[model samples]
Target: MDRSTGSGLSFAKRIYLPRSIGLGIGFMCVAAGLWPLQPQPWVWALLVFNGFLWPHLAYLLARMSKAPFKSERRNLLIDSVFGGFWAAAMQFNALPTVTILAMMAMNNIAAGGGRFFFKGCLSMLLGMLLGLLTFGPAFNPETSMLQLYACLPMLVLYPLALGWVSYRLSIKLAEHKQALRAVSRTDSLTRLYNHGHWKDLLHREFDKCRQGQHRATVALIDVDHFKAINDGHGHLVGDSVLRLLSERLALSLREDDLAGRYGGDEFCVILPNTPAVLAADVMERLRQELAEVRSELAPHLQITLSIGLAGYSPMQLDANHWLKDADQALYQAKRQGRNQVVSAAD
Candidate 1:
């Protein structure tokens, strides 16, 4: 949901209430400036509307608009206009005028930096002109202690509130970035690491094994006659078969073991600090486990895994060479017969 819309309030909307509360205080300072003049009923009414009701009204207007986010930005600029008009109406009272204008400037800068600052300045100036045209120019350089105290609350509290909002936004952005990275590395169907991520892990594991003189095993497992299964059953059933295998495979592995879906009907695993024999035993157990699985679509369908297991050798030059050894073993398993584990020769 758009945060700007009534469906959901966004971060900006979340910050607005604190800003409005501070603004109400700032407007009270403006009223203090205008008090000595004993302004007319219309002026008093305008002050009440701007000081008390405008913030809520602006939020609702944006929420009701076709594009709530965009409308909210426009509303911000309108706020600037009103701020400028009030500053002028107060006869450019030095303390109140500066506080009102500075707050508007700070708000625009926070929203869009220099660009929005410029646009907001333009709106403010236009509003100042409207005030000047209606009521003529007047100036009061002095401000009372009460008026100064009235402006103090906004100056101190508003920035702290805005800072909190910005901090939360940064944290949210970082979390979203992390989520996107995870999504990129994962396969949609199997919810396992994708081929590229698996390959990266393989490379890293190979490096660690070579550097630390540790044993690691790599295995490639293929679903025997997967094409025939898809042909016999519908694609939906074929997908279910893959999901079941992926789930069972995950459950069969140890905490430190890494598994990934290499492609259609082909999955890969990496086992650290394990010899070829131990890897073979693990793969064999996994094979039997998979064979016992009964498909919902065709309960009696014979399903099995052909796995090729190879341990890292010091003589192997690179990750690719080690992978090649496992691939060759996998081909040997298929050639010998489906549904068996083959260990590659060192």
Candidate 2:
């Protein structure tokens, strides 16, 4: 689902269950505590509606609205108002009154933090004032054992539900973070490592080579006459050619090999644990593979690759030196009439 709809659904779910459980139990506490005062039939009816039906009503009111989160926030404030009204109606009987106010405050804080909690408190006061105006100056400072027992279910279970929601949210966030990181690392078209990430791997491979006598070779591959390919067959055909070439290159390389699009029609590869000759051999095999490709873009056209190979050396100043060597060899391959592999001398 889209973010707003999913978020709305989550808000509805958050309210539906615990509110269902807690409010139903809360009504019983208020009912027992308010019994001595002999409230009107309408007051008992409101309590029944708030306890058994308000949760469903609030969920529908939020979920069906254009902006669910905002509607749900308002619903939470309404819950607090109902709590406050019930508190005054029951003559603020100690335990049930404390439980009602505390749970609604927690809901406000969880929904919109401290600022919303203040607003909820204000809503509570408004409800209390209405109750006072309706039935003046009622007070019952004591709580019976039965009333205290009724408050228990709401106090213990709702917080556990809140904790479970928080935990699941954390896991979903972590998965999204991992997916975003993967997108950042990959090239959009070729599905290979992008330039910057491939460069990082090159540097890491260089560092590993410097630590020991591990052999490694880097190659720069250029699609011969790539501009002509694009101009003659259109950019769409040019893109298909690049994708085809990348697929062939992937199939030719070993599992440990790293390949990347190095901008335009140029690609690069780092072959760990391979000598310059072996790297050239692999590229030569890839060259032969390209020779056999029959393009759908132009029936008579066959794409060719020019590759330059360079191996690690003690005399090389840095990773850039290795890259430069590969680049020089690529230039030589291009100059030697294209569609061939050239290796830098040891």
Candidate 3:
């Protein structure tokens, strides 16, 4: 579910029901107490809806599914489940009590962690605060200034606690998400960007070049006689050689250069803002670095790479056409005896 797009907001909206409902209930009750609502059936109904029914409903809904194991919905539902249970408990008990208030505060903190902590915590806290303020006079039967000051803890402590916990959890979730995204874009074996990511990024760069009135180069490199390496040294050594070459290419390439495992012993390097001459120089350096690394890994390993180079075409829509042209040139390099660089423009 490529949630990286605008569609990702839909995922968030799906799980918002429970928390939103609980928050709504809490808000109404708090509002009623603070705004001087005269004793009325509808106002009382509002209190009951906010304090008890909302949270309870959220909790019950969360328990219905055990699908949290593999989806992001699980994370969203987690908040709903916790908030719902807390809401339910509040309904059967005294709303203006410190114990119930504290529980609500803690539940809000847990439910709204990740990038959404502050907003979530504030939302839940506001609901409870309004509810308590609205119902405080009714519960305590005291309207004195001193009595109201004494009850101020009901307003502050819960929100503060909610804020602290939610913010902390938000940090943790953000870190976890970043780590996951990093792993997703990387090749497990070669530690370079995988083939799919390579294609995506290449096209993206190509688009940028088209808009910018600038140029970028793409180089396709194939390990010369890779089949023989696998046959003679076995797949394990072949794997080791590929890993070493990937590392060397990554380390030796300039910061603007992007390298990818295009599949098997083939690699692709996209050099942005580079002309053919500069790209050839870069590739020559890469060839030397890779050759040295190959010698170190296996003394007899004489691996060589045949490279085909092409540049961005402002007239072309995407990089695929240019890539195909580079690929044909690469085939020519192999035909003309491997271990050489061939330029499509040549």
Candidate 4:
């Protein structure tokens, strides 16, 4: 469905429970207020329906509408209109009138913010005029003990219900944000860090090394004859090979190490607090592990990694310079043999 429809569905679901509870409790307040005035039989029946049954009908109306969000907004206006009518119907009893109007205002502002709030206020005014015409204008600002007691449940319970709904919505929003962040930083194929995020991490690591806070090694890894594999077998097999290598890399590295897909067929790793010798050993172990891994898609296929390592050095001018050392060493490894590890400091 479209964005508006999706949002409307969500809005309707979120408002459903609060509306039900609010209207139910509101029935009591209006009933007690009107009991003192002894309203006609039909008026009493309308109050019963509005209090006990209207919330479900309103929810159904929104859910079945072409535009649920807009329907819900209209429903809110109807609620405001009823609130005003009741306030007048009770002859403006101080406690019940204030209670109903205040609750309706809270609901409007929460549902649609300021613009909708003004619209709801206008609807309420219309309702009050209708109420005055129907009941004949009369004033009874007095609030009895019984009226105050009836108003208490709505005053206490409705805000609590609204607050609970707001809290749940905030939590869902936070989870969505976190998932988006992870997706943005990850490689779609390998599930490793993406090129941009990996490079950002390299800059941070380079700065730490430059400040004498830590030592680290950077490695660039390439699959030997990757193009030949894709040409001979197919891109699907090529993808499987890359995924295998990524799984091995994740399994072999320390928790502090970082690995990323630098670009198509090329991977990079950062080993924090590691020297060139130790980084080379780690790469050699990874290379050996992959050499033994057989693809389920192509059982006879052989996988090998040519890796280059560069340890942090005071002589390097910047992060790019450090990366260049690793790149050059990678070139040397491929030059010497297709499947081997080479260290720049060596």
Candidate 5:
């Protein structure tokens, strides 16, 4: 559905249970306050309906509305109206009136912040006017022990329910943020680390190497005649080749190894705690495996990789120098022969 409708549905679902619980328990508090006034039978009936039945009806109204979020907001206002009516009906008894109005205000603030809270207050004022007209204005500030006891459940349980809903919302937001971070750092085509994130890791690895804390090797790999393949077979076939290479890299590399798409047809890898000699052997195996593979999309097309390796050296002035060494080695591999692995240290 559209954004507005999706938000409305989510808002409705979040509010429904808390509304049900609050109203059900609130019935006792209102009833206890009204009991001293000897309210008419119709008033009692109205109280019962508002306390027990209105929550479900409100939920149905919101769910069925074309504008559910707006409908739900209207429902909240009605709840505030009812709260005001009950407070006035109780002759503004200190405990029950405060409990009812406080709960309604809490809900309003939580739902829509300060602006909605003020709207709810206006609605409550309108309700108070209605109650004044119906019951005739009077004030009874005293609260019986029974009324105080009746207010306890709503005061305690409603906040807890609202707190739980807020907590769940916070957790879901955190998970979404983490997922977005991962997506931002990942290449869409190959599901490998994108160029920027890989370079970031390279910088960190370079720092470790410079500090003499670790040894690492960097490799740059380029697809052989990738432009020709793309021109002959189409970009779709070229994509399949890249995806296939990435899958093999993921499967072949150690868990600590980092691989990323450097750009168009070039990929980069960082092998931590490895020497150039060992890295060359690893790349040679990878190169051979890729050369033997054929793409399902272009079965007649053969794929090969030219790889260059550079082991960390204390003499390197910066990460860029180390990367330049690998790039030079990659150029050397391409010049010597398209399918071979060459090491800068060699």
Candidate 6:
């Protein structure tokens, strides 16, 4: 499912398009229905041509173009051009009471759906106030200020209701986007990061450490005699042991530390702003704690770990090279003894 990196509009935008178009169309349809009450035939024709048909056509053109919505510059251009054409269509004909109100409502709905809430609300209010000026005269050429007071209640309620609905929709969309991101980055088991998530974090942290000359460490921890445990006991106990081991690792590390399941029976920890010596000490303490827990939980089988530590240094090497050295040290620790800590050369 992976495509080119930085390739297109973020997934959130992709999901939002259909919802936005549906709302736009719904608002336009509402406007078209109200047209029969308007006194101007030209205004009804304009509403039919622009609010419903023309905007939908523009939306289709953009979809067919396949331009990513993430490009803000291009997106702005498209919105401006299409919006100008829409406004021109509305302004070309003489509008009436019902047509004006419908146009204002449709504009409010479209603007609120897209990221222009304040502008939409202000415009809706202004449009209604202007309706008082135009429609009031139609009823009576010398209509008093008292006459306009009757319409004020309905005018206020209209914008408030639309704003509330728009706000609710926006919040729901945001929650959906957040849930998608969590599912993409998180592992179901152990509740820690998966391989892909860990890799991205590693690269990001490495860049920060390199640029800032900030000390950081990577620790590779392998559960010793893991294959034997799986062979002697069933896979279920093996899985529990792995989860228990990770729980201990999570408890021992700092709040800023990133712990991930590298693969079966192996885990990696990224400790930001911690030097190699301190990272090694931390992992050693964790190893001792893990051994104690294993003794209490699974006395029938023994479990211990070997840890390899490597520090980040911009002057010495890049992120990949540092990780390679740490992995090599991990192999060395496994060769030297089952449960020990090994530090890589700077």
What's model 3's overall lDDT? 0.64
Q: Where does model 3 exceed 4 Å of error?
A: 1-147, 295-297, 314-317
Error of 2 at 341 (Å): 2.5
Better of 1 and 5 by TM-score: 5
Top TM-score prediction, candidate number:
5
Candidate 6 on 1-346: residue-level lDDT in tens? 2222233434324323432443344334334333333536655564455434644554454444555343322333333333333333333222222333443435434543545434444544544445444334223223223323433433455445556656776898899899988878766677778778987888888988878857798988899988888888777778888888878877888788999888888888899999999888898898888777753345667678998888886655667787887798899999897699998863
User: Against the true structure, candidate 4 has what lDDT?
Assistant: 0.94
Itemize residue pairs with steric clashes in candidate 2. none
- Which sequence of candidate numbers ranks them by lDDT, best first? 4, 5, 2, 1, 3, 6
Give the alpha carbon lDDT tens digit for every residue of 230-256 in model 4: 999999999999999999999999999
Q: Least lDDT summed over 10 consecutive residues: which range in candidate 1?
A: 3-12
Worst 10 residues of 4 by lDDT: 1-10
For model 5, the superposed segments whose C-alpha errors exceed 4 Å read 1-3
Each model's lDDT: 0.86, 0.87, 0.64, 0.94, 0.94, 0.62
TM-score of each model, in listed order: 0.92, 0.86, 0.61, 0.92, 0.95, 0.57
lDDT of 2 by residue, 220-312 (tens): 999999999999989989998889888997888889999999899999999999999989889999999998996687778798999999999
Runs of candidate 2 with Cα error greater than 4 angstroms are 1-18, 21-32, 35-38, 137-139, 294-300
Candidate 3 C-alpha error for residue 134, in Å:
29
- Candidate 1's clash total is 0
TM-score of 6: 0.57
Name the runs in model 1 displaced over 4 angstroms: 1-12
lDDT of 3 by residue, 49-133 (tens): 6545654554444444343222333443343333333333233133423333444444434544553445444454554455455
Candidate 4 deviant stretches above 4 angstroms: 1-6
Model 6 regions more than 4 Å off: 1-151, 295-299, 314-316
Better of 2 and 4 by TM-score: 4
